[model samples]
Target: MSKIVIGKYEGTIYPEKGGYTGALALGFGPDGKRRRLKRKGRTRSQVLDRLKAAVVDLETGVKSPANYNVGEAVEDWLAKGLRGLDDDTVVNYRSLAGKHVIPLIGKVRLKDLRADDVGEWLDGLAGSLSSRSLRLVHAILKRAIRQAQARDMVIRNVAELVKTPKGTAGRPSRALTLDQARAVLEAAQSSRLHAYVVVSLLTGIRTEEARAMQWDHVVAQADGEAGWRPVTADGFEHEKFAIYVWRSVRAHGDTKTEKSRRTLELPGQAAEALRRHHARQAAQRLRAGEEWRDHGLVFCSTTGRPLDAANVRRAFRLITRKAGIGESWSPRELRHSFVSIMSDSGVPIEAIADLCGHSSPAVTGEVYRHQLRPVITRGAEVADAVFGPGKSA
Candidate 1:
């Protein structure tokens, strides 16, 4: 950055346009090297106004050094900015900065950056990112730039002046039909994850919720006239099995949300699966002897260690492929399938929402709109009835 000077400097005055001549100010930088600052405007007054601001910046020492590059600033923030945050969050932020932000404009000097540079960088990412992912990338960049601005590293945050372009849509959530769900469950009967699959698909429990399950959470409700079945149902006197969704394997071993702590009655198949799985796990524990960890988790490996995501996913895919279901499905989609199945069976939306542990009916309705298609058809039906199909027109 150039120091403020007292005298006018020589510059070219263009004759083609009636405006302020392009001008310059001559001075010595902090390093004692000759420096020239340039400016132009639609009018001499406009040009002078900018020159005045530059002069103030130089006098007050607001101008940052031109040598500091974007890479240094972003790396500094990544190394020092994140404190007291979750380890997973730090890892994700670091990955995003390294993979997306640093490689592109890391070499550009902070003083040389412009709004257009930020815009072009984000626009180029549209080919590889989804709209949601682009927002995350933009947020990381904007936050890093803000950190620089707060410390007087840059005059302005160029990233804040740009908008992220909408990129590709994210993956569409899919649910299996009842037949496909049944097939997968049947195939899982031979796998170690049989109980986990049965609990998730039949009860609509979250994968995390299921992973955090303990044997103690499984309860047998005493048989009343309407054990778990409604008073009007034929099997009113049957015994009921339920699982208390009181915890998950989150950072603190808590459920995802307050409402997510629910108690759901399990179907007979899920109950039977758990019974068989408990016996199998006990046998494995004896065979492993002292190698068993004994976390008391309902789902575990052969040595009684708690199950991880990779374990469940591999087992899930294996059963899915065996059942002739597509190999692309995830365990979370079981909840979606549950919502769709209940919606198709004419269960009230609020009832389904309660079963799924959502905060409200609206939340369930919004997230599972694909499952609630039957309810939405009423609007079209009413419109058709009112207009008589537009035949009169």
Candidate 2:
């Protein structure tokens, strides 16, 4: 047994239960009551270390409990930090936290978590996860720790100090060639998804945007100065049509980005397909009678319910298979196909970017780099002309 004086407080260290215990009075609390902190460890030095940490925490206004662990902080962030986010996004973050973060370091005390610990955890995941997934997991951990730090739970965010390790490469996005696109279009001509496939491939709208499209957004030219009217309007007749891309299936029915909200003129093929599809839908609605629910979505199931992404993918695969393109193709590739076709047809980068609802041409170039063709080839021809077909000497 011994006495330790830390600043003005006289503390005592005593042997208890085969371990050393340290106790100190940390002055009066806000409620005018005396406050104290205690630390116990297997050795006197260990007890001293804990006592010192407690004193620093007290001085710094940190109110985190000694038993607080990583899992608790992650759960707190998951519960509060994810408010107002899309439901799918919330679910994804929760799934990642549950599967990767909580299971591995959940038991580690928040105070004891270190940059080395985070680095090691990410490295362990690098072998199994894709680089994109690893980055997302790392971001989740960093954000969780940041939330804890804001609440004075931890001194610093160790996750932020550690860099995300490179993981396995994800599958590279590919676009259908012109011939394959034609084949797919032909195969879809007789299917219920004909309009969906045509619109997605020709307009380059995101699958989420397509799924959320409402019939009210589909407008056609009218005779007045303010000429646009929804096709659903009575006596609607127009040679030209367009759609207002205003919303998506995301939580709260908002589009993905401000730039994602745009008006796109429908290609002739897409418009024709949609006209036929609308007629077919009206017939189906009559058949379903009271069973049909009017969500007002342009694309829906037999009962007018919104189509699930999984079901859309399954139906899309059947069309690709029928076109002899195999079943591995996804609906998103239709957008990529649009970019590739437009690029190959000599569309300007900026025009293509706007058409695809991208924020900028640079973003389009970066994302669809594989699909964009070099608009300039005269440089090589001029060089060849200047070189005069020179032979190597």
Candidate 3:
């Protein structure tokens, strides 16, 4: 309950109390509703200044009585300010608060929270988490504190005064050699999933994009020279068989990027693999009958449901182990191999960039340079010719 006190002037005022921080919730005139006057400044004098301002405002009929907490401020911010953010981003923020921020300083009075408190919290965070994670924690807290200030709850946002730790970068990626890639494909040949592997390597599409492919996007109509059609007589295109990449499946949602949504011409080997896999999947669908989902996905489980990416990874690991290929690799490695092999084969970087749907050759080079280094070295042979016979430059 708010305590009512007559203003130094003529008006009666009710000032609410007991917030996350020190506050002065000033009420209004006799007939008018209450007005909240909180101190957002960190210093006592600052809080008093805010309180005095609220008192004057109440005397002048300016604002309403308001007193809120850190928790309340967070809820309001999430509801009103975070509406445009995606579900995953919201979930992540909530998780960060629950796991790290709230437990430490949630009980502190919004107005009473000090820079020292925020700094201590960050110091503790540094001991257990990566610099990046700590920075995230700081960012979340800073936003929450700023919101509290805007709401007139806190005297100051301590998070603003604290410094965030620097973040760490991960090691560079390692790509597979030509022999290793061939070995992986050969090992994958006997599996029902062989076509998927071939397409991933040949097309350089991400796993999610590859998995999301539908039967509608595979064009088989040779307009004349060398282009695939939107659809074929057998239901999809490609001489080897039907294939498509119309939609991607994600655990939380869909494809990671809008640009990843694309269609491409399937190579003969990949098309054949798809033909065989499609046949096998069709038989399974026939057996399942009413139990099948019929998602129309080109790559799916026996009942037409999308395969889990995690399950795909595990199976891929098994295939590599069986192939006697020891170096660590993931499905993405094949995408790198595609770029590498294309570059080595003398395909213009621009053309390869288009084939891989890369935004620019620079990005393609940056990502696959580990694999494309050999091409760069071989191109140096031109320098050898210019400099005279057999001179290593």
Among these predictions, the greatest TM-score belongs to 2
How high is the lDDT of residue 311 in model 3?
Answer: 66
lDDT of 3 at 180: 68
- Residues 1-393, candidate 3: write the lDDT tens digits: 233233542222233343223344444758798755445444444555566666654555433234445555566666676665654467677887778887776766555567888888888877677787788778887887677566555566777888986545534455556666667777887875687887787677777677777766665755343555444244434343324444555543455555544556565666666667767887998899999998767778778887766567777777788778763567766777777766665666766666666677787777776666333322212212322233221
- Which parts of model 2 have CA positions greater than 4 angstroms off? 13-22, 39-49, 186-193, 223-226, 235-237, 249-259, 279-295, 300-311, 374-393
Computed on alpha carbons, the lDDT of every model, listed in order, comes to 0.74, 0.85, 0.63
- Candidate 1 or 2, higher TM-score? 2
Name the best candidate (by lDDT): 2
Report lDDT (Cα) of residue 180, candidate 1: 83
All predictions: root-mean-square deviation over Cα? 12.3, 8.4, 8.9
Clashes of 3: 19
lDDT tens readout by residue for model 2, 1-393:
799987667789999999999999777999999887799999999999889888888777778999999999999999999988876688789999999999998899998998899999999999999999999999988898899989999888888888888999888888998778878888998888989998898788999899999999999887664667889983236777888999998988888789989998776667777888899999999999999999998999999999878789999999999999899999999989888877776677788888888899999999999999865222112212321224121
Once fitted onto the true fold, the runs of candidate 3 whose alpha carbons sit more than 4 angstroms away are 1-164, 189-193, 222-227, 230-263, 287-291, 301-303, 306-308, 324-328, 374-393
lDDT (Cα, 0-100) at 58 in candidate 2? 79
**Candidate 1 per-residue C-alpha lDDT over 246-321 given as tens digits, one digit per residue, 9 for 90 to 100:** 9887667778789989987776667777878877887998999999998988898889887777668877988899
